[model samples]
Target: MTPTVIPIDTPGLGDRTYLAHDGAVALVVDPQRDFDRVLAAADEAGVRITHVFETHIHNDYVTGGLALAEAVGAQYLVNADDPVAFERTPVRDGDVVPVGDHMRVRVVHTPGHTHTHLSFALSADGEPVAVFTGGSLLFGSTGRPDLLGPDHTDALVHAQWHSAQRLAQELPDTTEVFPTHGFGSFCSATQSEASASTIGDEKRSNPALTQDEEAYVAELLAGLEEFPAYYAQMGPANSAGPGAPDLSDPELADPAELRRRIDAGEWVVDLRTRSAFAAGHLAGSVNFGIDGQFITYLGWILPYDATVTLLGETPEQVAQAQRDMVRIGMDPAAMATGKPEEWADGAPLGSFPVTDFAGLAQELRENPDAERVVLDVRRPAEFDSGHIAGAVNVPVHAVLAHLESIPHQQLWVHCAGGYRASVVASILAARGHDVVAIDDSYDESAGAAGLELV
Candidate 1:
């Protein structure tokens, strides 16, 4: 009588949504805004989705519980404490929600990530089998308690301590743990490579479990880096019960309109390889390349409501790009495919000049008098641990708002490799700055780049 669990990963957000079924009926937990995947899972399992659960008002990404439940004619269950604008089944602590004839989930009030969060413990044929921990207790780490802002951070941290310990004390050690965050995702206080775990494994391996309440809270708070600014929009959107937008292929733009968007100062986002974009692109077009963390950077900088013109190499690439955008609640205005030269139409093409580590060293030696800034776009932790001498540290996520860090002269940018460096180079180039992107391996040429490792 074991329930089937279909774990779906959203690689961009480092999150997972699950469809748990008892063969005849199914339930979804913390689904992303896009419903097609979850719907497909239900269809493949040959079960009707009868219930959708939201652990809390999600701050990282919009949960599709409301809209998805509506789409499939299922009941959307939310915490009674959350004053969502729409109608939903109000769930309270210790409530046993029956999924089908053989399986039921007992709601546990595990409020740490948010004040109203609830984790569900699944029971199959009256035996505890697994638990949907949501943001409560992740596999190797716990959810960051600071999403509620400064005033509530300490309180949430304290709550997080008790809630985590409570989960361990209440649930059996053998119960499987399925969490919604911390899969190379920024939502966790720290990162873990684990995809799934059992309660017994978590008790021994999770860092928070080893420390006292005060020590755990302090450690968790100190490890948090800047989260995406677009997070502010997610909670409101999810609470309003977002409707499923048409993720169909956008209208293809002719060269005439592509030129106009460039003239009008709208973002013409180019989705290609970093190497490809570095070679050549339409002047005024910026590259947040499709092959790397495209969606994360899209949310990091682009105005949430802005309609961007998309440029990709092929129709298939553009279509794949659209799904990446729609999953994060972004919709592009138009899409086009072709060479930069074709779209440029007699206008000057823009390109980022890539310098290998050795060549970059030679340039600095030759022109020590030249005014230039070596900008490192890695995280603060990476920069603090070790970095090249005189390279200004500005994480790619925070670069858009912190343009004043630009040194007012020539700019040379490098990340650990070249993917993030390409993103920064594109942003600076769009603003009419002279930017050089380093395309070589940072690890191999630490000596060449004159890195200062501690």
Candidate 2:
């Protein structure tokens, strides 16, 4: 059987890596820091990974291609234009790498997501099958052009329109499309959960394909949102050659050491549920709520490069949380597992004020002109769809930058759900603002809580 392309998802990053083989040989594309799944899958199929290819110098996670290729003795490949410390089999557009007796990999120079982006054409039995279009093209939306920094955004977006047009016009309608970023990833220009699409499907449905180039660029540029603060560090790590994947248990900290770190103002991240954390946590610790969309805010809400301590409910949980943090290039100094009451001993545990949707409604009704600022931390597009009549639309990542403009009076915070509200509440509270977190459902609160949606 011709080995079909298998998409391996990294849930924390909301990205997918692919594996394709022709029974005897395989190719790995855009792997994350963890390569266990890729390696194991190749082994199970009894195929050696002949080539490991990167779609770009990724700005989302530290890729594991170099190490994975070394382990399997496979040729690692990257675009010729991508500057990196280590050596790789540099490839350019139209270059084809033979995989087996019947399969060949064609390189397409698709530059949009980055200056040196390339998409792989996977062929079997001398027939075109699929393209691994990484960040260049996604399910519904294309990759955001601003990932390289503000300077490259304008030029990249213009290039993105051309790159997208190339794919639509050149590739056959039946060719399957696989991409690296989508499904809650900040890398995508718009919100979509579509798993995969075909050249025909995209050409007929994608706005970037149907709309004029100028209109596509305008819509694409306007839809970009604030990404994580740690994003700035990703490309550098990938360029310098990241250290070996070490998601192993960080040195376990006893209660005393954990307490000392918290007292020292180190970023002690509580990786429990929001309710568990809000009930009682260490005085100086912050709640990140590992179970819900945790990784997206990990680098944004916490201090970049600060010594971090992970407090999970168990050692296994701590290990998982550590993996999520390191995949995005955030390293923790130490980690521990237990409740704050257990670690705090006699010290007073801290709790934040939690208001339900109804409680916020009552507060607004009573205050009349109190003008309680409902700070919506969701993306601008999400806010534009429907939000509280007077809720301010500053996203979570831009909250710190917009602090000077917000009032010092009573501030109410809510996201699409309660997860982000908890994060924003902690951040605002840390900055000496009177913040109340609405911990209830956003959709439920729309009209039930006397909220007038605009």
Candidate 3:
């Protein structure tokens, strides 16, 4: 029987899910909270999942192993050292789990990314065939040591270095190496273009393993980017085993119902297109459209405790909106019931109109006479490559934590596109500051406008 690997891409979060085995049993690795694609794939393949495994307690995205277990009556597995509050079958080093007549998975404790990280070695006919090195060893880069904290940098790097060397020495040269995270994942310092690689290739090319432990640790720490504040809340939520979310079909409510919920202090999150949202959204609804970095912005601006009512352009849009919310550690209870049009009754949510290129040019001219605070909400590297003149660089994810440093008056915000600027606008508005989101067109014209970067 040929083993199959399913790549589950949960937009705004990352990739997960593994469907291994010839045909009878499935082993899912790190099925995150937003696993619509994984569920759909499993249903299409007609496979009965037997085991769900989480390599570790994920800090960036909520894990779906518990939910998948509940849905399919599968046993949830994790390393024996995990401090998670769930009843999981603890699999330790050298433990073999029988998959079917001719296959078995050998658990290997490869704890480097976190204190409880695990990897699995797949075997057929008593010979190792593949290895699932969740975060311990990626295709190009190893997992970031900073996840554990600055204090654990040395220990974590040493642990990862030793773990990779162990795998390189123990696993066969021909064994395939599949990692949980790939390119675009914030978890690793340098993710590979491809999702999977062979053990021999990684040993030859991975920089993390080739460098000394101290130098590797220093390089990893220095290259670390600021993660979302919401990341801290995800680890516990994933470990606790999420309760059944309200998966009921959305009921269409009248405008009065939408207005009533809004009045009752529920946050109306408009998941429409930014242009459409700018054209019109429910009075006072926060506009974070479906197209952009919806989950990242959602985590950045929305309060952890706030109840959110989603306004989507289509039925599928609403479902995606709900799924994205769960990915970022927001409880399903926070999701508001009903369709977009139905809930959009009463006065509009307070609108912070976007400024076009021409409007932005005018604002810059006018602000020069006053205390101008131009906020650049891009990543640090992006900020370094040239940014708007006289702009303070505070990444959108780090903005809330560093808000005290931002001047409270007359702040203008812009990102690579308009999406992040809108997110920044919402955050500043909540803080009672006067701010405006510059349209994407303005960012395109920044060079023409003679914006200088320091």
- Highest-lDDT candidate: 1
How do the predictions measure up, each by TM-score? Answer: 0.96, 0.92, 0.86
Q: Summing lDDT over every window of 10 consecutive residues in candidate 3, give the lowest-scoring window.
A: 332-341
lDDT of 1 by residue, 320-402 (tens): 77877777678889989988988888878888788877767877889989999888898898788778788889898888778
Q: State which candidate has the highest TM-score.
A: 1
For each candidate, the alpha-carbon lDDT, in order, equals 0.86, 0.84, 0.73
Model 1: how far residue 395 lies from native, Å: 2.9
- The segments of candidate 3 whose C-alpha lies over 4 angstroms from its true place after superposition are 34-39, 249-266, 332-371, 379-386, 398-410, 427-434, 441-445
Give lDDT tens digits, candidate 3, residues 207-273: 6667777777777777777666677787778767775455554555457766776678677677877
After TM-score superposition, the amount by which residue 59's alpha carbon in candidate 1 deviates from its true location, in angstroms, is 1.1
